[model samples]
Target chain A: MKFSARNVFRGKVKSLKKGPVNSEVTIEMPGGLEMVATVTTQSAENMGLAEGAETTALIKATQVMLVSE
Target chain B: MKFSARNVFRGKVKSLKKGPVNSEVTIEMPGGLEMVATVTTQSAENMGLAEGAETTALIKATQVMLVSE
Candidate 1:
């Protein structure tokens, strides 16, 4: 699929935790860099996300915040 | 709009820089929080991203990385 976001990472699904409205998904990238994604339960179900499944984490730079003290 | 991904932040557009293929957008959130987003020039144009424009930065948790040192 074509997307406008510049940051995309390949990952493997590590775990899935269901919430009321969203489901928390853990994705393990290379070098053990793990990321979490909260998606709608429907979306999670549609993607068939499960343990050991391969997926991608698409990110927009605007979504990232940097803090310095 | 119905998006499967969770994590949304409301902000005003701080700046928009056009690149060869992609455009960099800076968004300022509440309480001085700022975030940067890189999108395709076409996408930028489609979204009408510009200075002072209000926008929402949609992020999936899977897109965020954490490091503990």
Candidate 2:
């Protein structure tokens, strides 16, 4: 999909944990790097998300924050 | 900081584009990989974020996705 967000990563859904309002999703990339995302419970169901399903991890650079030690 | 979500990348601030409400920030990782993020104007200024500054791009795996062709 054509998206304005610059970071679009390919990953497979490794696991899913549902909560009252939000769901925790883990996607592991080809490089073996893992990322975790939090989405609303409704959104997860709407996406028909399931374990082992291939999906795109869309991260808006704007949502990224910089921290220095 | 100890963050619950995974995928914390180290990078340098490449540029910043400010809008009325949101600001676009670009960070370049060590391998020359570039990632972009969007933040609020207030948050950007509050953080005193500027170009050429070192920062951490925090991405939750949940924010990431996988897509197949």
Interface RMSD of each: 4.6, 3.3
What is the lDDT for B20 in model 2?
99
Q: Which segments of model 1 are wrong by more than 4 Å?
A: B1-69
| Regions of model 2 farther than 4 Å from truth | B11-33, B38-54, B60-69
List model 2 lDDT by residue over B1-69, tens digit each.
Answer: 697557787878899899999998888776566778888888788888898888888876556544444
Task: Look at candidate 1 and tell me the lDDT of residue A5.
Answer: 67
Worst ten-residue run, lDDT, model 2 chain B? Answer: B60-69
Per-residue lDDT for B2 in model 1?
36
In TM-score terms, candidate 2 sits at: 0.65
lDDT of 1 by residue, B1-69 (tens): 334565778899999999988888999999999999878897788777779988888776557899998
* Pairs of residues clashing in candidate 1: A36-B61, A36-B62, A37-B62, A61-B36, A62-B36, A62-B37
